[model samples]
Target: MTIRVLIADDQDIVRTGLTMLLNAQPGIEVVGAATDGRHAVRLARQLRPDVCLFDIRMPLMDGIEATRRLAGPDVADPLPIVVITTFDLDEYVHGALKAGARGFLLKDAGPELLSQAIRSAAEGDALIAPSVTVRLLAAFADSQKEPPTQPVEPLTAREEQVLIPVAHGRTNSEISAELHISPSTVKTHVAGLMRKLGARNRVELAMWAHETGRA
Candidate 1:
């Protein structure tokens, strides 16, 4: 099945570049483009693409608010969202995930990683590929500690086993191989762990995992 995508950004050039890069992939296509947050949200709701790529800053509504509408807790059915931004700071990255973004990526995160992120989002997997995930998220994650007020749920032994590699940034296939389980089984376990831990995506799971010394 083709992975449908919607691109939302104020810059025409950036939107065009991303659309072109993703379209070149085997099973990916851009369904539409939006120039601002409000339009992005409208197109996303109407089209229901496999993934929505949103920029952080835009007129009428910013990415954060758009993210909340599409994937926030209040939404009856949340759509998967990947936030693409030039700003790669902790606050934006963390904020985007909190607002329900599945993945947070930097704009300069080259074509390969950009395509990979879209594919991952469509697959219900989280990605913060090297060019973006490492340079931005890693530095922040390494420096930060767990929030004092947040108490995480306890994990089962199987969940702990599953989280080990995910916390270290391994892909589902990698985790499956390491755990001697099928990819589908790995995905199921991942979903279960995510719900148990109240994690938005693998990145947040990783943070909570390491904080609990379960990594």
Candidate 2:
């Protein structure tokens, strides 16, 4: 199945470039493009694309709020969103994550990273740009005043093994190779961990690991 995408960026050139690039991919399609956050929201509601790509700075509404409306925890049926931005400012990154963005990337992260991010989000996985992952997450981790609540269902030893690598932003395939497990098995463990930890996504899981000194 092709992955349907909605592009939301204020710049016409950037939007056109993204549309052309994604549409050229074998399993991806750019279904709609919006020049501002409000229009993006409208298009999202209308098109119901598989994933949304948002630029942080936009007229009428910024990507942060757009993400909140589309994918925030409060939404009953949240859409998956990936925020792409030129500025790697901690505030923007933090805002996007807080607003329930499944992926975050720098604008110049290259086509490979962008494609990977979109695919990850479509797969219900989270991906942060590697260049900024450790530094940005570590900064957020330091600001936490309290650790996550202990889960009613405690993590098993095997699950703990899975959590460590995942906390460091390892993909299922990477974790599988490291732990001598199959990718499907790694995914099962990851799903179990997310359930036990009450994490909405992998970033939250990673944050919990760091806050609890388990990472």
Candidate 3:
């Protein structure tokens, strides 16, 4: 199935480049491109794309607020969003995640990583750029002493097997190879764990793993 995407970036060059890069990929389509956050939100609600790509800094409104409006905790129905930005500051990462962005990537994360992030988000998984994954999660995990209020049911052994590497930032394909399971099976396990743990996305799952000392 084609994964439709809407991109929001203030820079004309960046927006255009992302459009071209994503549109060239198979099974991916750029449904709309917005020059600012307000436009992005408007277009996203109208287009109802499968995934939304946002740049952290934008005019009219910032991507963080836009993400909050579309996918934050209070929203009745949340759209999947991936935040792509030139800056990888801890504040931006934390803000985006809190605002319910399902993925985060650096602007220079390359086409392969960008594509992987889009696919992962489309599949209802989260992907953080490997460069920022460890540090961001560790920092986020360190700031909070209380256990997450999300996880209710305990994880099974098989689920525990999957959780460790995922917390370490392993992708589904990598996890499948390491566990000698099909990629689809990895996905199934991931979905199961997310539901059981009440994780909104993979980043939250990773955070849970760390917070619980399971990683």
> How many clashing pairs does model 3 include?
0
Q: Quantify all predictions' global Cα lDDT against the true fold.
A: 0.82, 0.89, 0.89
Error in Å for residue 18 of model 3: 0.6
lDDT of 2: 0.89
Error of 2 at 128 (Å): 1.1
Least well predicted 10-residue stretch by lDDT in candidate 2 = 140-149
Predict model 1's lDDT versus the native.
0.82
Q: Using alpha carbons, what is the TM-score of model 2?
A: 0.88
Q: Which scores better on TM-score, 1 or 2?
A: 2
TM-score of each: 0.85, 0.88, 0.87
Give the poorly placed runs of model 1, Cα more than 4 Å off: 129-157
The window of 10 residues in a row where model 1 has the poorest summed lDDT is 146-155
Task: Sort the predicted structures by TM-score, highest score first.
Answer: 2, 3, 1
- Please count the clashing residue pairs in each candidate, in the order shown: 0, 0, 0
